[model samples]
Every structure is written in C-alpha cells, then in structure tokens.
Target: MSIGETPARPRKKKKHTGRNIILSVVALIVIAGLVAGGYLWNLGRTFDSNSSKITDAFPAEETRPEVKEESKDAINILLLGTDTREVRSDETEEDEFATLPGGGRSDTMMLVHIPSDRKNVFVTSIMRDTWLDIPGVGTAKINRAFASGGVPKAVETLEGLFGIRINHVASIDFEGFKGMTDAVGGVTINNPIAFRPVHNKSYYFPEGEQKLNGEEALAFVRERKAFTGAGGSDYRRVKNQQLFVKAILGQILSKETLTSPAKIQGIVQEMAPYVAVDESLDATKVAGIASSMLNIRSSDMEFFTLPNNGPGRSADGQSIVIPDMDTIEKFGEALQRDTVDQFVASTDLSK
Candidate 1:
C-alpha cells in the first residue's frame, strides 16, 4: 500500500454502482410507462367498443320533435347477455360452456340509464320469458328479439316495450362473463340456500358468503333450482343476478384490481372478443361514459325486476307471465322521469 499507488483506486466499485443506478432508473421508467399505457389503452378500447354503430337507430334530427328547451343530459344503454353455447369450435370443452354454435336467446336483458348529472346508474332487468311485440315477427318472447334480428331488433323491441330511447347496445357472450369473473380472481356471492343442480354433482357450495370461481359463479347465477330450495323461482334467480352484478362491480372498482397490470390486461383481453357494440358506439362516447361512471358506487346502482306474478295458462294452455299493466305503467313513468325513488315507492319489492 505505497502512497504513490493512489490507494488502489476503487474503479470496480464505481463501475458497479453506476450500472446499478442505470438499471434501476430504466426499470422504473418501463413500469411507469406500462401503467400509464394500460390505463389509456383500456379507456380507449372501452370507448371504441361501446359506441353505437346505427345512427339511425334513433330518430333523425328532423324526425325528433322540436321543443322550447332541449334536454342535453343523460344517456341510456341496453346491456345484453346472450346464452350462446358455442363461440369457438376448436376451444377445449371446458371453455365452450358459454359459447354456442349459433346465436341463441338472450338470457339477460338490462336497460341502464346514466343521467347527464352522473349522480347514479339506473338498471332495470327484464324477464327473458316476457311476452312482447317482436317488431316484424309478431308477438313472441322478449329474448327472441336478439335471435331474430340481432341487436338492432332487440333495441327496437326494448324501446317499444319501455317507451324510452336507447342510445347504445353492449352485448357480451357467456364466455366473456366467465373470463371476466376469473380474471378478477372470482367474486363473493351470498348464497341464500343450500341446494345443488344435477349437472353440478360435485359442486356443492354451502349456503352463506362464499367465494366463487368462473364456473361456480356462472352456475350460481344460472341456478334456478338451487335458489328455489327456500321457495325460490325465476324471481329469486333474477334477484341473485342483480346481486351478482353489484358484487362484480364492487370487485372491479377495488384498488387491488385497478392497480394490477397483469389482472387488468387479462380482463381487457377476455372482454374484447365476445363484446359487440353498435356501429355508432365509438371510443369517445365510451370514454366519456366511463369517466362519468367512475363516481358511481354499488350504493348508487339500483336493480329491480319488472313487476309480474307467476305464469298463467293461456288460451293455448301454454304458461305465460301475465304482465300487470298498471305496474308496468308506473315503472315506465318512473323511468321516463329518471326517478328511482318514484318507481320504488309505488312498487313492492316483496312480490
């Protein structure tokens, strides 16, 4: 250790330190870019996917009646869940449960109203078996609208049924629903009964609060027989579906999911393929709606089934849900005024 040796200069240490700092900065930049890019990409994708394709689906400017004061607020959308069993022919059997070879009836029909004020989201679930006008096809089951003429006809039928203007349509298949549930690491459902379906022989889930996987979650919502164990029926099934939607929305908004890159990507990818939007639904509209929806919470969402009692034997001896005209009219008025309180006040939830 001679003094002229310059204390054996720590060149190696300096070089290592420099390399480590550079690597650390690069990693941070990459991660930040990914997070930012994912957020922007997802926002853009949702906007594009949800825009309406059919501008004429609504009346033209000339056709719309002119008023002293025009309403610039609020938008209404139709959310459809189709029961198609086949999406891809080559996919494994397990993944093919939700995909159907051809288009089938819609298992779920929901009309979502997002007011211009962005205060809350109103959801009304229509029964699949509800008898309604099928446009050119005469009277038929409401679910048949989608199968007969696709989304446009479905929208038309719904518009006619409810007497409200629908601005957009978002239709997703069964597989997409399952994929979303799995991507979010499953959802928690409060089971009100302890019953099992014949198909799910080994899938015995006890009644109570339980976490559900993709398959189990699907079965939970689709199980009419199980919900009936405690005197359940289609009405009970509808209630469960509403609860499931709320649970899903809550899960999606949690910080655990919003901040996870891998989970977000998985969800977006799964949702992209099976979702179809009207041609008019573009990225801008979707982004605007999503930005507005950020403030909405599970508490802000309201779900209710159309008022109806059990099915009755018609003149042909076929069972059909007899719609109570008075109840339906009350529901329609509440919707037209965008007042859930008005609707729920007059209606009975215990039916």
Candidate 2:
C-alpha cells in the first residue's frame, strides 16, 4: 500500500460476450470445414474409382464450340444403360479385359438435354439396335460401338452422328437401373396397353396408371415383345422407358426426397457401384449442376425417343432399327443450335 508503489494492474477480467462465443464459433467452423473437405475428398476418390475416362471420346472439332457454362445454351449428357452384371472369376485381369468387348453392349442409350432455363429437362431415348456408322470402325449396330470400342467408341459414334458435343457420359448396369428405381421409391407409369412381356411372364401390368416397385417396373420397361398391341415394337418399349423416366423425376423431386440431402447422398452412393461415368463427371461438376438445377421440378421434365423406322433385317442378316435420317437431321440441327425447344415442339414423335 506504499504511495510510490504502482497499484497492481487489475488482471484483465475474463469477458463473457459475443467475442468469446465468436471465437468458439470460429474454431467450430474451422474444424467443420476440415471434416467436410476430407469427406468430399473421399467421395471424389470413390467416384473416380467407379468411372472410366475416355481420352478419345470426342473428335477434334467438338472442343471448338464455346458456350457460357450453365447457360440456356443447353447441356447434353449421354446416358448408356446395359444389363451388364459384375461377374468376376479367378481369371487374370488381362482375361477380364478380353471378356469385355468395346465396353460391353449398352442395352439402352439416351441423350439427356438440360436447357439453360433450368425449367425442364429433355430426355430422348435411342433404340439400342439402331444400325449406324461408328467412327474409325465399320457401320454396325449402335450398341455395337460399346462392344467394339467401349464407352469412348459409343460416345464418338453418337457425337459423330448427332453433330453435337456430349458434355458427359454415364454407363450404368442393370442393377444400377433397378437400384435407382427402388431408391426413388419406385415409379408410377401409365401403361398404354396391358401386356405381359415375353421376357418375364410371371408378372402383368394392367393398362392405365400403375404403381410399380423396382422389379415390377423393370419388367414393365422391358416388355416389348410380349406387347400384342401395336406389334409390341421397339418404339413401344421406348415409350415405356420415357414414361418410367418421368415417374422417376416426379419421385426424386417430391418433397420426400429433396428435403433430405443425406438421403440423396446415400442413394447416390448406392448407385455409384453400378455406374461408370466419364472423367468429367466428377463430384464438383455434378454438385455444380445439381445446385443450379435445384429449382427444377419433376413436372418440368420432358421425354422423347429419337426417330427410327420399325425393325428391319440388315444385309448382313442382323435385325436392326433403321434410322429416320430426315427427322434425326432436324433434331440434330435443333440440338446443335440449342433450339431443342423448337425441336420438341414440332418433332417430338413420342408424344
């Protein structure tokens, strides 16, 4: 207490305020960011592992066109579906490669066009048996491109035929197809005619609206031959496919699915194994597209099938779907010019 002695500095009082809370928040945010980063990194690795990159997929002229990213210019995705099962044997890896031709035949193929407005998506299914010119390979069945050259060949064939750029490609197994249907809680399709598919006589779908679970849905889509109505044609099958797709969109955009990000992620994880995507279809690309298109509802999507003549036998004795080149050319032009709206308005044959 000596007068000359400096009063002991009062220890700075520990303040309980926003700053303390802010510091704690900042620490939490940093930790959370690190964890999220790690999770995303791991997810990316998983996606990359399940996919095969196509270096020669696109021809030289394809990379030329310039369009604003995520604009109304339209983004095109080539979706190839195959009934390929993952059968592994004790055979060496080299033998495994030998067993797969092109990349295994894509039983179903479609071009998914997402216009810039983000209001709706356009899906056009291509008949798998269409005979067409495969770039650097001889003319053959469209599905044969995968068997001859893998996904790259398939992509190249389609891109060459269509005269447009395919931004990404996703090849999916039948299990993935079935799994996705189930993940979306199954799809409800309106059957134009009641028919039991020859592929599976065990089940029958009555005409009109039908709510189908995964197995039933797959059967519904695959029943082209058993359809006695309209000759049970391939085009008929395409219609079934389109109908099922619309139902899927409805299910995915339903409040039940969109409200739960964890559920969506879990579904995607389950689908990953049965899917093989292009190198460009990484997590960042997918996330960016999904975030931008969040406003799109199932009602906004439209589906169609590429124009094709009825089945015919080729000179080589292969059954094939002949191309309706005139209509297809118009479609290609509309697609190239990003005027798919016009194409859909006038040339959507499936309607």
Estimate, for each residue in 196-242, the C-alpha lDDT of model 2 and write its tens digit. Answer: 86756899888898778778877776556765543246678778877
N/CA/C clash count, model 2:
5
RMSD to true structure for each model, in Å: 9.3, 8.7
lDDT of 2: 0.70
Q: lDDT of each model, Cα atoms only?
A: 0.67, 0.70
Regions of model 1 farther than 4 Å from truth = 1-38, 42-72, 86-104, 225-233
- Tens-place lDDT per residue, model 1, 1-351, is 576676455887699779999999999999987877677677567535532243334433442322211223557788776566543454333223322123433567788877667877777787766767778888766656655665666777766665667777777666676888999999998877676764567777677999888888777676665554322456677777788888888888788987886786677776766776666666666656777777777788778777776566556664456666678777665556665555776678555
The local lDDT score (0 to 100) that residue 196 gets in candidate 1 is: 78
Q: Pick the candidate with the highest lDDT.
A: 2
